[model samples]
Target: MLPKFPMSRQCPYHPPAGYAALKKEGPLARVRLYDGRTAWAVTGYAETRQLLVDPRLSSDRSRPDFPVLVPRMAAAKLVALVGMDPPEHDVQRRMLIPSFTVKRVNSLRPAIRRIVVERIEALLDGGRREADLVPEFALPVPSTVICELLGVPYGDHEFFEEQTRRMLMATSTADEAAAAGGALNRYFDELIETKLAEPGEGLLDELIVDRLGPGELTRLELASIAMFLLVAGHETTANMIGLSVLTLLEHPEQLARLRADERVAAGAVEELLRFLSVADELQRVAAADIEIGGQVIRAGDAVYLPNAAANRAPEVFPEPDTLDVGRGTRHHLAFGYGIHQCIGQNLARAELEIALYELAVRLPGLRLAEPVEQLGTKPGGSVQGILRLPVVW
Candidate 1:
């Protein structure tokens, strides 16, 4: 029997144990899927990068034969810009690029810092010794930042957050996930309707005034894109913050280094991104027969590129299991490679760097309330993170 695709990590800090074994087999190893079908898992760093940028691989989720790793993935509405190929993907990404450019992210640094400080303060109120960082700090900080960024009413965070949660839950049935996705789309639909009457200063309003109103993009497309931004703009960052804190706490010496020198923050965050690699495999279907890494992936074959495995490839990162904050890792696939790579990479980088530095410095006395093995995680979705990070100082 072939190794199954979508293996879960035995430790939140590591990729799935099966991934290492798969890598041992070859770069393009055959894997079994949940639906009794077979797919190719690109486990080697070089092959993963090669496939990620190969134009022969299609990201469109609309194809009838598209691979469904989980039930939730069947709901194509959740894959706006990511589920696109060239021309459409290029156009949509260019439109959203202005909002996430380096200059724009630098402008948001102060606001991100303020948000992190406020969350830290909340965790420290009345000299409290402990709080579940996921709810108290990790989740809310990015959720609030993204809410303000997208012009969504912050008061309704719980609604959309829950919907996004259900939508991304791997345990969700196809119908259940569709419902959750529909709720978010409808919410964005109505929100766009509201903005149509009176615009705001956020990204959604900019699209409404420029793209939506002019019919350059349709209501459905705009709403789908908005939902994507709302869910992605925050969820991934929130998870990264949670995982980074846990990683640093486990490595006290590294934690001390991060706290002592603010200069190391950028490099440390990049290494953390490389170390954590919270995202799931980047999925695509072969558009044509393509030969790479001595294997031929035929047209319509499902290809899974697990970045977690690639990030830890011993060939690329010597001592890959060890987390070195000063490695200055610039080539890791924490953000997917090629033209379809993460659009908000700049914003996400800023958020992680600020949050980790602030939390380490503000709570230098921080320690895990429980053993790392005992902590529960919300892993195996489109993203991976702890469900709660109980900590004390």
Candidate 2:
């Protein structure tokens, strides 16, 4: 029998040894990481890949057997993606896919670069000699880039940034996170109203005002979609920005090489993304009893695919733990796999590439201003990232 792990544990991210332990233990094992809930953690690369693609795994939280990882209210706020089974998830996903395709994202490159350059300039002019890169550079650049892409007013950027931070803080009280989420929904509602009045050329406006008729996306659903874009797009890229810089700074030789060879920078970003595997884990409920990798999971059971653990699997990646930029690690699950793969991946790549390329070129002498251990990661960011990256160029 597998060992029983309980849900009364601390944050999953705090357990650094858990991945190593899981690897030693077995492919499929029970975990108690959620708030007193029993869940399965699947570690083998092939197993995780298979599970992610399988229709038997469900993302719906409304089911009677929903496996919750947080307080009810907070969990609801986090899993707001149209949780319907395949066809519905397929429809909503398809609707948003066009906005994040390679071509569409590439089209946004010039605008993204402009945003990066503008932010860097402002940082430099506004006393960037010593600045918290997360707030001053990493956070806002993507927040605004996504905002502009979605047609949210630049003025509301402040509101989105603040509430997003509150919602992600691991220590946030249930009420506090819920309040932040509500504030975001209210802001999006008003923004939706404005867009309906005078539809802007932005994507959100286009989706709401153009795609949907009178009552298509209910207020909650529309707000949820908007919230998804804002938080996911914002936190993921921001963390990459902060973490990539820190990684490059720590390995001066790699940083120097990247600076010397612009061609290699893109590869460096991919490798760093693979190495960091910023997203912690993914949650799914077993739609029905299914067997995989020689294990049986019953219906209503929660399964966690630790993409981080899979990324480090020796079978898929040789010397998986090492951060080698030239290894050609293209299939990393950093953006996830199969149907639920991140829709904003192309946009994220554009943003990371631009940020790394520009920062290397602009801040040639940049280095971490504090001890490595002193730097902190955001406590509760669904998309894991640095809390503050202090640097001086």
Candidate 3:
């Protein structure tokens, strides 16, 4: 029998352990998905980069052929930005490019640094030697930063965060996921109405002011974008911060290097992204019959790109399984490749660099409270992360 796709990682420190055999199968090999559908697993780093840019592959989730890696994505409506294809995708992305530019992200560094500092202080409050980093530190830093950037109130983070967890958690049934998603949509819908009445200086507010009048965007799209940004903005980065901290603790020499020299902080973040690859899956479907790696993916076939595997390809990264903080090569597909690459990558990098570096410096004695094996992974979801990262300084 073919190995199942999305095989779970037995340990949080690496990709799903089964990817080694799968990669050996070929660059584009077939794997069985949950629904018993066979999709082409793009396991080669170079092939993944080539096909991601190919126009024949579609990111559109609306298609019946789109792989439902998890039940939540099955029959779901297309998300505003990530689920689109150009020129609509291009149009939507164009609206936000200026906001995520290097200059703009750089301007937010002071504020991001301040946010990381506050989170560290919170973790250290009451002279507490131990706290769950997931809630106390990792989750809040990016949550606050993204909340401030998107103009969404950080006070309501609990509601939205729970809703997002429900939507993404693998255990959630389709109905439960649908309901959680609906709750978020309704929440954002109301928030949009509120913005209409009392404008705030958020990205959503700017969209409402600038685009709604020109027929350039709709209130619904605004809500979807808000939901997407809020969820994507925090959950992924939060997990990254938690996992990156755990990783650094596991590799003291690398951690010490980062703390000793601030210059390595930026590259360290990149290495962490490549090494951890917390976002384990990036799925696409063939729009037409396409060929790569001596294989043909039929039209309407799903192509699963486990960047987790691709990032670990030995040919791409020497000793692919080993973690190297100084291996800051930007060649990995962690943020993805092609026109659909992550728009918020710069912000994520800034957030990770600030969060990781600050923790290393402030909590020099930081160590994991629980045995690595005793820790729980994020319940089934496309995103790979530790459920609760317990730590003490």
TM-scores of the models, in the order given: 0.98, 0.91, 0.98
Higher-scoring candidate on TM-score, 1 or 2? 1
Query: Which residue pairs show backbone clashes in model 2?
Result: 6-32, 7-36
Write down the lDDT of every candidate, Cα atoms only.
0.88, 0.75, 0.87
Model 2, 217: alpha-carbon shift in Å? 3.1
| RMSD (Å) of each candidate, 1 decimal | 1.1, 3.0, 1.1
Taking the tens digit of each residue's C-alpha lDDT, what string does model 1 give over 1-393? 998778887788888888878887788899988888899999889888888888999988877778899877777533788988888889899889999999999999999999999989988889899998888888899899998888999999999889988887778888888898889889999998988888788999999988987889999999999999998988889889999999999999889989999989999988988888998788989889999878899998989998998998888899999988998878999989999889999999999889999999999899999998888766564688887789999
Evaluate model 3: give its TM-score: 0.98
Clash number by candidate, in order: 0, 2, 1
For candidate 2, the lDDT comes to 0.75
Highest lDDT scorer: 1
